[model samples]
Target: METHTELVEGEIDLKYSLAERVKTLTPSSTLAITAKAKELKASGIDVIGLGAGEPDYNTPENILKAAAESMEAGFTKYTPAGGLPELKNAIIAKLERDQKLTYKPSEIMVGVGAKHVLYTLFQVILNPSDEVIIPIPYWVSYPEQVKLAGGTPVFIEGTKEQEYKVTAEQIRSAITEKTRALIINSPSNPTGMIYSEEELKQIADVCKEADIWVISDEIYEKLVYNNAKHVSIAQLSDDAKERTLIINGVSKSHSMTGWRIGYIAGDETIVKAMTDLASHSTSNPVTTSQYAAIEAYNGPQDAVEEMRRAFESRLKEIYPKVAAIPGFNVLRPQGAFYLLPEVREAAEKTGYTSVDDFAQALLEEANVAVIPGSGFGSPDTIRLSYATSLDLIEKAVKRIDEFVKTKWQD
Candidate 1:
């Protein structure tokens, strides 16, 4: 057996071994959570998991039918590395029709998922020491991906009071000479905070002055609740439109997480570069998945509406109940099926010092599972997704309420 040698002082040359860049890469925290949830479930534990970023609902029927039809028609061969012309065209049309931001098919590129597109864009566009502004509590992948691209990540932290959304002033405060990009996730993943059109305009104004590119993750664009408007930063003004990469997919909106078909629509130069990277990397998402994605984009949007309504109902229903839990302060979310709740009071009230401890105790004593806020760049909170069935959320919240009240009173 060949044994690996350990370095003592300086074993040969360490620089030639592995690139120092890859060493800084971190694992995706979202995947880390789902993996932990799976481990607990495999133990035959009744874990009411709220750690899932994907919707619990299955993909829509029309999408599945499209995949089946495409397969039957023998559309299984490898496609153009960038994407199928039909899918790219559909993406272009969607951008023009819905977003009112016109882009040619050349400016649209489909990848595995919105996450993949964003990560790849960073890889191709980022240079050493280029700064990417990320707002906290951001989607866990944003900062990691930026860092993996050898760019410095500048984080602007906000709290529940700010709705966990950053202001233009905050973005301005973080700007430096090396700043190259700014990521904005409207209707953000963990916090479910949606920025209004006016709010985006302010941020775009500052970004325009600084000439920073905007990577807008609009994956949850269709999931806003309370009739809240989800504004695309790119659509705010002509200046913003020229530099925005709008990312969207059928993952959350159509419950097609496994399908892995995501696309980017933006400036021709940036999108083409990203598309070329996609062509070389994964080579145009899966063929059948692209066909399915076409159905998701062009088919009846009613199913999307239904899912959004269901999530909204659950969000409203869970808020009061979750708020009733002693020491848990939940800000009603405007979009996405998540609640980034401050659980510090609950932890302190319950004699637990941290969110990880509180989350473990909840899973153990209450048989309820929720992602610790520590994973989402906030250690004093926990994310509660209302994407599951109402019965499960109801039962979990009840258990959580009972579990917290017995030990903590605040």
Candidate 2:
């Protein structure tokens, strides 16, 4: 929201209009809140930030070494637009090892990150007026990416009663002739609810019957806890395999967020078109990061499990405390490093007209930052990422609890 200065007496002034696609685009709320917390911290404020979406751990040592070796070995040059063959093969091996899904190199396209890979997928497959089904309380980017592709995002509410998951019947009812695809994010961000294999089976059947694509975003596949299993919709059957596209990356798995490596696996024609688009857009993903991703998949997986264990431990320790806050109701997360609690009652009791305003008050007065659920299509709730230290999380929760206590009127 920056403003431009007026032209001087003799200077020419140019006015340009932004594209329709970007004119109404909403910036990512999670990132915006995190940035604000960092800004406060930079100004010497004692901010306890609960808005981070990335792991606090450094990238695994082996992956870092691999990236360094790739640079030293002159593998820093541009790779193929799709990605390096070796990296794609490693990704294929990962699918086979984890999900028992077979894929060839031609079917895989690596992009800057899972976010960018999704954008590329939508761009290639969507046409004007097409519709994509997005479940409620989705990751903040899904609807925006759909709209950017000239596609309409048709939302289906996933009620808290259903553990914040959309049922197959809902998907069926939401479909129409304009429906081109459906996005499924298991171990969902904000909610941390993992769809069961049976749920995925039912959903896969609906997608096959409807003859629409399923964009299965399994970026948090490796981060499940509580003995819960992660299942890919593609594994449901041959038809599901043909219709589902799996998107994932090393960022969440290997603490490689800064590495900027992610990929999509599906039909070769779709992947090829995305690759062609990327060639004209990004040229290629960072060459060293691609090489590092190869090692991330091929190297020891101990660090990945270690980080998952840490997040699980924090969730167990913090869920009760967060739920204990007056007027806040939170479901225990099955996976990922987030706790989303419905705070509408809390906001009302504390005199805030909206959850977003309550969240801003928490940042300005309570010195903690949390992403309001309005950004994730669940305005009654707020998302608190537990990716920070347990101590910081505890302190932030305490601040929020005390803030509500002080503001309570009834």
TM-score for candidate 1, please give it: 0.94
For model 1, residues 1-410, the per-residue Cα lDDT tens digits are 95666668856655457876678876554464566667878998888887667888889888899999999999999998778999988887777778888788888888988889889899988998999999889888788888889899998997777889899999999999999999899889889989888889999999988998999999999899887988898887788988888889889889999999888888788877887777777877899999999988888888999999899989888999888777878888899889988989889888887788888788777777788877668888888888889999998899898888788755
Q: How accurate locally, in lDDT, is each candidate?
A: 0.85, 0.93
Worst 10 residues of 2 by lDDT: 11-20
Question: How far out, in Å, is residue 4 in model 1?
Answer: 5.5
Number of backbone collisions per candidate? 0, 0
lDDT of 2 by residue, 43-140 (tens): 99999878788999999999889999999998878899989999999999999999999999999999999999999999999999999999999998
Against the hidden reference, what TM-scores do the models get? 0.94, 0.96
Error of model 1, residue 300, in angstroms: 1.1
Candidate 2: stretches off by over 4 Å: 1-15, 30-35
